[model samples]
Target: MLKFKTMLILLVTMSIYSGNAVASPTSQVVKDRSYYEERGDIVWEVPTQKKTIAFTFDDGPDRKQTPKILEVLDQYQAKATFFVVGERVERFPEIVKLVLSKGHEVGNHSFYHPSFQNISKEKAVNEIGKTQQAILKATGHTAVLFRPPGGSYDQNIINVSKQNNLQLILWSWHQDTKDWRAPGVQRIANKVLKNVRNGDIILMHDYVYNSSQTSEALKIILPELKKQGYSFVTVSQLLSQKDNPNTHIKVTQ
Candidate 1:
């Protein structure tokens, strides 16, 4: 009986030590990269009750319109995401850095703004890969979000994005400002204000053929939204609020 009791105690002690050795703090638990990679593709708008929206601009690093839009956002202390064309980024690297410096998020739009649905898988991959390289080179930051040119995407785009570890971001149809059409500034602002809602992703452009109207519309949209108690955030920040309610969004600078 004595020997059996000693053996039982030793087994209990060993079990305790083994448990201690494998124990990990909740905060220290690391998820596999695939865990995040699997979440990639197709984030249109986060579903949340919070009155937060994300404004996403595409095809930019425009010397004129980008600066003007940034100024308007700065005046309202709002944050946004810029889905920049890699070729344009290379041409205007300074504007890329300026976008980042002003506390906005930058995402890869594509190298040449090609429609993904019409491209081969290899071409899609190359487009995404080259833009990823360009963004890193210009900003020293790897972009994890990609918005296909013209918001057109397919399974090929999703596969390429997963292979490159990028999330495919799209905008809500209702919130598209259509400023690229150069609709009068008031009309552009009205399109957004009239259709805006919680958890919306507003789409606008900075380097459309003529985006002066976009810059003008922002002057009205930003202040009006602020007055309506809507907070503008980056795409990642808006998604984070929905995915991890406990997570606080630290505005990227």
Candidate 2:
């Protein structure tokens, strides 16, 4: 009993510290947004009364890592969105198929994973449009969501995305696990376990640099969040939601 109580106290303290590692989410909708804001073409979070989150992964369809992540999601019966790079999708189209076959989602994350902020309008168009074709060819999945590489965007990137009929998708403020950094498995797990809220879009990655920490962390994150009564959904599913009691309009940075 003493040991159990001590562990519980430790977890509580960890949660408090880990939860604030990122800035608190703001109810101030559309503060720093631009053309995308005017057209309502971007999203970070959509609050619904249902205890649900949109688990989004960027730069994926990696042969080994993606499959491992998929296995964990399958174990939990959780659905998520993979914002895949066009070149990677071309290289491992089967992985993309596996993602869709498992009832998950695929979105565009650019062909070369270039920063849209630094590229020209035409370059951005090539990246976004080519990726749309790549994802469609891979699994016949039309990627309506496009997340810019590194989550950095400018007016031209936004306009190009609009032309391609893609909605910009970024993650919720507090839910960045940064597992790609090979942070310890427990650290990656804690970042997510502590900060998740209803309608949050949690960011993770499958193609980390020499790291399997994401899949390992998912083993911890999925079951814990599931036990907390949170249901996971694709980004599109979260956006299509009807007004619920927990409706939150989060302003993206």
lDDT of 1 by residue, 83-103 (tens): 999999999999999999998
Which residue runs of candidate 1 sit more than 4 Å off their true CA positions? 1-40, 243-253
lDDT of each: 0.77, 0.79
For each candidate, give its TM-score against the true structure.
Answer: 0.79, 0.83
Return model 2's CA RMSD, one decimal: 11.0
TM-score of 2: 0.83
Cα lDDT for residue 230, candidate 2: 92
Give the per-residue Cα lDDT of candidate 2 at 251. 56
Worst window of 10 by summed lDDT in candidate 1: 16-25
Q: How accurate locally is residue 219 in candidate 2, as Cα lDDT from 0 to 100?
A: 92
- Model 2 clash number: 0
Deviation in angstroms for 88 in model 2?
A: 0.7
The candidate scoring highest on lDDT is 2
